[model samples]
Target: MAATKERALEAAVELLGTDGVRALSHARVDERAGLPAGSTSNWFRTRRALLGGIIDWMAEQERADFSPALLERPTPETIIEGLCTVFLLETGPFAARTRARYALFLELAADDELLAPLSRQRREFERWTDRLVTEAGIPDPVPAARTIMALGDGLVLHRLTVDPELDARPVIERAVRALAASVG
Candidate 1:
């Protein structure tokens, strides 16, 4: 039963990533998950409930995937590299999940009720970035953090469609350095 729920959420992520929000449905999730026809409905009961489950599932996956050691790095370069490594899907492991997250973000923008989790995530990221930038002795930590995050978002979005083959490490390093210098 637990495995069934896990497979349903994983299917939701894959469907959202590949087919966009409009393609999500209990039947589709069930089909994708290879579960019985009513499995997703049995678990989620309603569209809203299913969506909430997906959001919760995403948050849990992200928390599990994140590395706390990345946050403890003392140098800005190392910190930025660690951050970019996740954003760029450098190991090719998180590519689908990352794309699904972006797709969910777009969907969240249009639905106010679904925005809370994403909003909290964004605020948490901003806070973390602000702390990191401040530790680096950068001036205007808030603005610097915002700029760095925006750069990362733009790069990820662009990479998703424009050039999946592009190496993002060098680009991310240069951008982080330039932004850090600007605030220094």
Candidate 2:
């Protein structure tokens, strides 16, 4: 049962990533996952439920990869390098997930039920960013953390579509240094 649900969610991610949100449906998820006709519907009765499941799945996957200890005492250089690495992964290996996440951000902006889970994911990262910036000697960590997050998102989006081969390290390094220097 869990395996079937996992497959359905994976298929749903693929659909949302490749074909956009309009292509997502229980039947399409079943077909994409190669499960029986009722597999997706059995697990997620409504589109909202399926979207919520996907958001949860994404959060689970990300949580497994996150390491809070890494931000214990980070420097600007470490932050820049870390953000650049994440940017590369998002634009390259994790491009599909990135695209799907962006699609959901735009598609479900007005729906609080769906937006809540998504916001939780963002909030987790924001907290991490806050900690990193504060430890790295940024005087105002809150807005700086938000700026860093937005910068990473914008850079990832640009790399994914506008210029696939763009180098993100320099940009990240510049921004991180500027933020770190804003200690007063």
Best by lDDT: 2
Error of 2 at 129 (Å): 0.5
> Model 2, poorest ten-residue lDDT window?
63-72
- Model 1: lowest-lDDT 10 consecutive positions: 88-97
Candidate achieving the largest TM-score = 2
Write candidate 2's Cα lDDT for 1-184 as tens digits. 8888888888898889899999999999999999999889888899888999998998787766666765567888888877877887778777888899999999999999898988999899898889898888787889888989999989988987899889988888888889888755
**Candidate 1 CA-lDDT value:** 0.79
| Prediction 2 TM-score vs. true | 0.93
CA shift of 176, model 2, Å: 0.4
- Candidate 1: give its CA RMSD in angstroms: 1.9
lDDT of 1 by residue, 45-151 (tens): 99888988998888778767764557785457866777677775622676667777777788778888887887777677777778888887667778877888887
lDDT of predicted model 2: 0.86
Q: How close is every model to the real structure, measured as TM-score?
A: 0.90, 0.93
Off by over 4 Å in 2: none
Residue 38's lDDT within candidate 1 is 92
